[model samples]
Target chain A: MLNVEKIRADFDVLNPESPAKAPVYLDSACMSLKPRQVVEAMNDYYANYPACAGRSSHKLGDKVTKKVKKARELVTEFINAKSDDEIIFTRNTTEGINLLANSLGLQKGDIVLISDKEHNSNLVPWLRLRDKIGIVVRICPTNEDGTFNLDNFSQLVSGAKLVSVVHTSNLDGVTNPAKEIIKIAHQAGALVALDAAQSIPHKKVDVRDLDVDFLAFSGHKMLGPTGTGVFYGKLELLEKLSPFLVGGDTVESTSYDSYKMLPAPEKFEAGLQDYAGIIGLGEAVKYLSQFDFKYIAEHEFKLNAYITNELQKIPKIKIIGPEDPKLRSGIVNFYIDGTDMHKFAVMLDEMAGIEIRSGRHCVHSWFENKKIYNSARVSLYLYNMMEDAETFITNLKKILEIL
Target chain B: MPCIVALIVFGIMGIFSASHRALAEEAFGCVFKRITFRPCNTGFAEKIKGKILSKLLVRSAFLAKMVNRHYEILSWIFFILMVGSTIWVGRGVYNFYVYGSCNGLNESGFCAFDPSGENNKVTSVGDDSSCGITQQSEQNVTLENINLSGFPAINTGSKDTVVFVGCYACDYSRRAYPDIKKLVENKKSNYIFAHYPAKGDTMFLGEAGYCVQKEYPEKFWEFNDYLFTADKDYVLNKSNLDEILSKFGFDVKKISDCANSAETKTAVQDQTTELKKTNLYGTPTIFINGKAFVGPKPYRVYRSAINKFIFF
Candidate 1:
């Protein structure tokens, strides 16, 4: 089991004994709070050896190159990829999705399949590709309970060139069956890509085990620095794809008219990278490796189950996903019939410093399709205690009574 | 509605703060959208409401609920109040420029700009004085039909008249006299000097002024200038007054003889009675082009009264 109290001590923001009340941060699914270790790792790079990696042969440069290589290796191990060369550093999940959308060499009339509940980061890139290249984009609808409908997805993947979808719906935290979906898609001869931004933080996502052809997740979502993400591909698959953004270190040699490109990861990484952020991401992975995913999942589910039960007691509250808290994972998304969810979220913030995500959670297409305006989402993490859930429920009930 | 108020407030506050400037820009966009009859869904109002309710909710959830329920109505109320106060401040600024008091001529009320009411202060006429003025009515105070024939006068032929009724010994008048002198000399108007003893044992100075004007009319202005600018102790000393008269090329014996006469005393008293007809309430009362300025004014006030566009 995870020692949550000791884990809380690692984050300064969770200092409960301070003069001011520490924020009951239930918005971890949006962006996780960085621990002292992750911050210090970034500080070490900027303070001690701030230099460009792979370009310079000097001592500082060699130090940066070694640190960057170690970070890449950590990322590979984190995702259980075949080699470090399969991993490419990106700004965020959006950039990684965009790189795949542009570089995957899909031609006219080639079909790209997505789920009904994909985040805009996973949805927009494919839509843009469809628009620019005259390719067909298909939506595989979810079940009535907001869970992935594998039967419908299997039917939709028949002639699809690529099946890119969110692994876990950030909307309601209903994680899809990525392994089964990948097996079915591979049988249909369609490449499978999973947007694992939400899933990678709380659970173990081994790319080799799932055999997902492509996977992208953000560092900030997993307690790393913002503007850092990792996109992993099958080694041969990454090497075959063209570089979407080519510049500076992406090339081996350049002339006025022509240039020879570097290998997979280097060819994709353009200009100067976020070296500090990459180093911090590695430290974040090391920190996560200490904890077992089973315990993290259990801790989150305990809090989510409490929140879900308490929220169900409140009149007019309708949870977005399935009634079962086990399926919803860490996120407990709900909306009152006539109340403004944004205002409700803000009230929670003001009343008890309970921070939660509001609005569509970047899943506007789902909301628009369902005719739902917005929802307030409480996403739990391993560090969240039962006290945080009780406080959130108490404050929410007080707000409801007053209103 | 909140955007309108935010636009004005944040636009002004934007000058000193970059964060406010960003809000002002947002308010500008929101207000622009609102004026075009489109829905103001820019979230500016919601953001502001959230900020306000966030603070309010911590203090009192019931109050926050009430505010949230009536947010639009409250925004309208605030908008109206902001506009009303803006107009009120604008009028106060105008009145301060024109009348030297935020509450118009000679009215001593609280002015935000001149908080101490220094611009409207005067050396008051004492209760025991025989100037024969009992009531203070600023609106009723005017220069119509008041005879100016027997007063110490200069610039007689000019159309624009400046009548200054003051005391030589009064501090406010002494402070005002130099600026009034410069204005009168610069404008070259029909300037009349009426000496009413509003303070001190200065009735004798009034008789001395009457005598000096009568006996040596050519040096009367220079003599008046000297008395206003001179030390109060020196001006009050009878022998010093004679010495100054002498310096102005006046015969000390003749001026002293005229000053001591009962006739000259009656003349100064009659001058006071004539000045009182203008409802004279205080010392340093100046009339520029029929506009009765009841206290010592800045030179620009006097000059602007004449030109109505005095930049200097």
Candidate 2:
């Protein structure tokens, strides 16, 4: 097991003994706690080399260029991608998904399959493509219990050009069977893209292991700086996809009349990048790499189980996802009966210093279908401690009683 | 190579909402997808140079080459200037945002006497004595609660009401701050902080006291201690509120709402009403046993007044 106390020391906000009560930060599955190292990396970039990279020949520019190169390499290794060439930095997972939606040649008659539990990022891009180009978007069904239904996926994926699904959901924290889905999709002669925004932070997601052709995830969700994200595609597939954003760095050379486009990653990245965020992302990956996935996953499982068991003891509170804590990953969504969820959330933060998320969890489509408006979500991270879960459960009882 | 990577970093870092959106999402994600992806355009200089070189090349290729050769030097200067300007402008913008004016001087059309700023200071303006309209409203306040919530009276006392009507940021207020704080620390008298915000931001700063008291009812003094002792020109905003509230681990958004609430505004109005009752001449005005201290005075004098109120 990771020495969580030592790891917690790296995050100033999570230290329980600090003068200020460290908030029971259960919102990490949305955006993880950035280690001190990640922030310092970004601050160093701003303080030292606040210069334009790639375009400038100055010393600062060269330093920035080198930092960006190192970051790309780190990301390539982090995802275990084929090469750094296959890794493209994006604004966030949404952009990565959008890039694929616009670039991957899915014509009017072609089909794209997605899980019903897709966040708007994975869902909207395909829907837009379906409307803009003549393509059909098919939803693969999840069981009544919110687990993926493999039979329905096989039925809907016939003649589909691509199957893109969220690796893990922010809604209920159930990780979809991506490897199995990928294998099945590949058998159906379809490409696969995994929105790993929630999964990549918690577990080891090797592209080689899953045989995933495309993977999209955000840095902020993984203890990196915000606005930094990664889009990983197989080199050949990336080469085949046309450039979605065409300007600036996307080209090797250009004239008024003609232009020669650059390689896969370069062709996609058009605007000035967030080097600080990118470098910080590299630093963040290095920070998380200290603890193996096995340790991290186990820590989360224990905390989730503890919190879930405590919530089950409460009267009239319903856990939204799978009853099994392991299936819920680190996310536990529940709503107490006979209370306004929004007020419950406010009281939790104000009264108990327990910072949690209460809303539809951005899976409003699924919520709307069920007619459930809001739920209080306690999402954990690697830095979260057993004591934090105890505080959450204890505070929860106090809030419930007071409300 | 430069173009591809140039923007990669800048685009990610410069977009304000990148981290802001992340904060909102990590907090609970967004209510709506307001700004999903806004990439920072990093190669602006290159684009301008490209345009300039293209224009110059049409005229004379030799001159364009000559200019291109020295572009590295020009870029170095540009980079330095941009960084310096961002820092410079950032400070000015922050000060103006916090202090309600440039250079962080609170500007009330009526200038009360300030002992802190020298004549040369950019923040100082208007005669310090000019703001006073000779004491009006003769009905003296009893040794009890006023119309507004200042600091809740320490204890219901037969002791005289010491009404303090001043801006915490004003020159004389800075002088009186520590001494009054010393008295407040010693629990000298029943102090009523009747605020007359001579500067712009202090009104909201006063409102913050009442707002904060709503959440942590007992920490009004602790909050007041922070207000009186911090940097003379430090301003309050949402993020600054985040720092202060997080210290106590309170909900920043809730406190911020109360600070900006209509009820808080009513509390400030009551403060103004209380200020009117004090017959205020200038800031650092102390009303003890129906007598007044006009400007900053000795700690012993305040001690004597408290001594008189208790013993007389």
Candidate 2, number of clashes: 21
**Per-residue accuracy of model 2 over A157-182 as CA lDDT, tens digit each:** 88988999999989889999988999
The most accurate candidate by lDDT is: 1
Q: Write the per-residue lDDT of candidate 1 for residues B194-261, one digit (tens) a residue.
A: 88788768888888889888887888888898889988889988667767877877888888899899
lDDT of each: 0.87, 0.74
DockQ of each: 0.38, 0.01
Instruction: Please give the TM-score that candidate 1 achieves against the real structure.
Output: 0.93
User: Which stretch of 10 consecutive residues in model 2 chain A shows the poorest summed lDDT?
Assistant: A337-346
